[model samples]
Target: MKRILVPTDFSAHAENALKVAAQVAKKNNSEIILLHMLELPHQMNDAITSGASIPETMLFMKKANETLDEISNRNYLDGIEITEIVKMDKPIHGITQVSKEYEIDLIVMGSHGASGIEELLIGSNTEKVVRNSEIPVLVIKKENPDFSASEIVFASDLSEEAYLPFEKLLKFAKLFDSKLHLVTICTPNSFKPTHEIEKITKSFISKFDFSNLETHIYNDTNIENGIINFSNSINADVISMCTHGRTGFAHFFNGSISEGLVNHAIKPVLTFKV
Candidate 1:
């Protein structure tokens, strides 16, 4: 059965993501894993080292469990085997470790975007997991539930890794019954295709049951601009891509295309790691 992992922090945004995950899981007959990570307050750890009251820590843990149960019960997630995991540690580390251990197929998390100094530090936990995960990650913005993905735009380099996650995307498209648009942006300095591009495109199409698929190629100066323009032109509901999760100097100098898309795109962006 398909396993979907959703990490919650008892936030409304996380709850929104769980709602969407429930819809997807219900449609696919998949199982859902609800995860909660409890990172103690910074001062609490210092207090513990200084021989503070251990009962306080116990109270905090109890509260965390109560919060998880409250959210789970509120959602009334039924017809699926819902598993809950609560961990006390760093949120990102806890999530990444659990994802690998469970072999999660998809991860649904919530984000409120980035702000000020936190933008440079790590942006958000959803962003970090999207970059670090080897599975598909869907970050939902908590607001309204009126969003419907009518057209799915995929930004790819047509590399060997590009096709790896298409199976999951196909499953997503089928669930939504949305049209799948495959797009590739070619740079001015990039090598032109030696063989027929249609041959490669046809080979990829043969792998999926895509009765609603369209292909397009654009000659653009920059990858980010090309994707944004195509998405705007098509009025895409969601933009999907694969990211390599380069950090440090690389992330600073050469910002991630997926990150750029998320920051700029008017539509929701879903990222899958290969």
Candidate 2:
């Protein structure tokens, strides 16, 4: 966790994310890279790519840099090394490209918590970044979030494929020095007897030999609701889950339940691809 990448549209939500990034950076002695993507007009997109010296591009870059400078100067940002990045690309593409190019350890981003059809339009950028990013992504949905997560609820299916993400989750939990509450959401669509669920949960726990952890099987109408309810019941500070990184028609048809939680969960969500 040497570096954190934070993409901003300068909205209240993005400011919340930057605040969270600052907290994490201070704790880890990390650098915060604030990125602003300049989504050029359709006609200027291709033309400006070839050193066209377009005034619009120049103006956009100048304004973005100025905004970043202003944000970096905030009193809250003191003591942390904040770098501003302005790129000419789509938000998702720019974020992914910069994350890889800079070798960022974690990507902290904010979503407006859009849902239903609105989410498909507005919230898709953050969701797309989550699906595409190989590194772990932490999503903040509120305007002012508690960056320090003392209690983290990690919800998983406990499958063999889940171990990798769970490993990543452990590293994250260590960062916060938080107790982990491992849980499985038993929904109506995939109901399981309590004895059977416990057997499987115990088997998975044995593989990791994880100590100072508690496990539970939560029942509800669906995975999203179950995770939310369980997390709230325990007064969790962070909600974590694994995503399969499904894309194309598979993602379209099945839709990602983890993503659904991302859209609605008020607590910070830590997600990684399985």
Candidate 3:
């Protein structure tokens, strides 16, 4: 973890993400890039002719920079190297662009936890980045989440596509020296015999040659609910999963399980693109 990118709206949840990122930075001797995005206001030609949008946009930019400075000067950042960036673009675009520009190792972001139709339509900016970024993303939902992950719950179908992301997930899990709890969510629509589930789980585990892990099948009405219930049951430190990176209106049809988890799960979720 040489460099971490944290995008902030300066909300309490964003502050929570910053704190968690600080912990990781402290542990790995990493640098923190504190980024803030200033969305350009939309208006008609009349507003542009009157120069009304200019001052408003400038004020917004000024305020954003001030907030970034305030966050970077906090006492907790004493030993951490912090670089503040203020971008004039949408949150997701700014974040992904900066991540590439700086060669960021990971992106830690805050989510407002959108759900159902609202979740699909008005997906949070954090959710958008999780869907598009090539690097790994850590979605933080609460204030002061435990940074030291002792146990991680990874829910998946153990499909061939999942194997790639699972491999990246293992590298992240090893950073905290955490035990992995692998789970297959058995929903009514996709239920499998226990023996079949067990066989696949065992094969996946053996193929990976992973240690310090356990596997099981969890029953629920859906994958989202199944993951939430099982992680809560195990008191998992974090939830690791793979995103198909579905975008646009197409996401409405393909429906990413990773996005669903990000919207509903209260625990920190680490996502890798499949």
Candidate 4:
């Protein structure tokens, strides 16, 4: 991982994420792209593209740049190369565009869940980013004063197609020397006998060369609930998952469970599309 794109609205939650990003950058010597986006007033939205003549857009951009300057110069960000970006665009679009344009290797953002959106709108947009971004996303839900990825829980169906994302997960886990806990959620509706579940789990992993790993089969009422409960039980530092874009988790038929977890998981969530 090289450039980490952190989209900020200058909220407390966003600052929480920046603190975490500083930690990550120090460890990896990566560049931080701190982006601030403005969804201008309806009348000024089109005018923003014309030039810097519009007063509203200009004012917001100046304020955003000043705020970015303040954030970039903080003691916590000292010695770290930061590229502050200010643009007139929606948060999600700006993030995606910058991620691609800069060839961002990872995206880190903070959230206070969907419930806290009134005071932290940018924080809550983590759901939209997790639902859409192709690049790996690491979400910070709250202030993790002493963040470390010692234990990571990766919930998946262990399908053959899952190997690709798992490979990506492995690279991330190795960053912090995190031990991977690979879990397969066994739900009541899709219940299987213990031996059958083990047989499948073992078969899927047998073909791969994985080290510093443990396998598990957790039972619960549903996939999302199962994942959350299992992760909490282990006190995992991070919850990793794969989603099929808008269709939600590849294992789920419903179209919202992936974001549901992203919006609700108390621990940080690391997600990417399959």
lDDT of each: 0.70, 0.79, 0.78, 0.80
lDDT tens digits by residue: candidate 1, 1-274: 3889988877666777788788778777878888888777789988877878578988888887887776667544767678888887787898889888888888877666433213311246666777777777776655435556679998775556666667678877777788988877766654357355566677777877777989888666767678889988888888887766665111211344535545555456677665
Model 1 whole-model lDDT (C-alpha atoms):
0.70
lDDT of 3 by residue, 1-274 (tens): 8999988877776788889999999988999999887665466335656886777667777888898888999987889999999887777777889999999999988766554323321146665777777898887777764576788988877877778888888887778788999998888878899999898888888878569898978999877788899999989989887766665211212454544655677788887887
**Residues 46-138, candidate 2, lDDT per residue (tens digit)?**
777776758878888898999999999998789999889998777888888999898999998876664431342125677777776788888
Better of 2 and 3 by TM-score: 2
Instruction: Give per-model CA RMSD.
Output: 4.2, 2.9, 3.5, 2.5
Best by lDDT: 4
In order of appearance, the predictions have TM-scores of 0.78, 0.90, 0.87, 0.90
The 10-residue segment of model 1 with minimum total lDDT is 113-122
lDDT at residue 116 of model 1 (Cα atoms): 20
Q: After superposing candidate 3, which stretches have Cα over 4 Å from the reference?
A: 44-59, 114-123, 247-255, 258-260
Q: After superposition, how far is residue 167 of candidate 3 from its true place, in Å?
A: 1.1
Candidate 4 runs further than 4 Å off: 46-53, 114-125, 252-255, 258-260
